[model samples]
Target: MDIKLWQAIIYIVLALIIGAAAGFFIARAWFKNYLKKNPPVNERMIREMMRQMGRTPSEKQVRQVMSSMNQVK
Candidate 1:
């Protein structure tokens, strides 16, 4: 009877662990999709950032930075 009880506990623990693992992956995928759909940073932000650093951004410079940023992702 003791062995049976321990076996049941192990099964429940295993199920809980598996469920947590699945949730982590699912949440990660959802977050990735959300970020892709609504990017936090845009060209304007990059331009502003450059300006803050004492550099005036030309359109071409902004475009290059934007392309490189996207490529890094």
Candidate 2:
């Protein structure tokens, strides 16, 4: 291919890559902020349970609940 064609292709590919990267980062940041502001109610329930029980819930318990919830789909 000619140099101009190759340059145009490369520029298009670079622009796409940069746009995708910017979108991913922006989404990640936004979701993180959203989660912080509104945490999952189930997780909050678990935290409260741990406080009442005077012990932290095991990782297994948390994972089990999360997996079960996911499996409901």
Window of ten residues with lowest summed lDDT in model 1 = 36-45
TM-score of each: 0.57, 0.57
**lDDT per residue (tens digit) for residues 1-73 in model 1:** 9999999999999999999999999999999999999978899999999999999999999999989988999
lDDT of 1 at 55: 99
Model 2 clash pairs? none
Q: How far is candidate 2 from the true structure (C-alpha RMSD, Å)?
A: 6.6
* Residue-level lDDT tens digits of model 2 in 1-73: 6999999999999999999999999999999999999886586577677779888777788777777877887
lDDT for model 2, please.
0.85
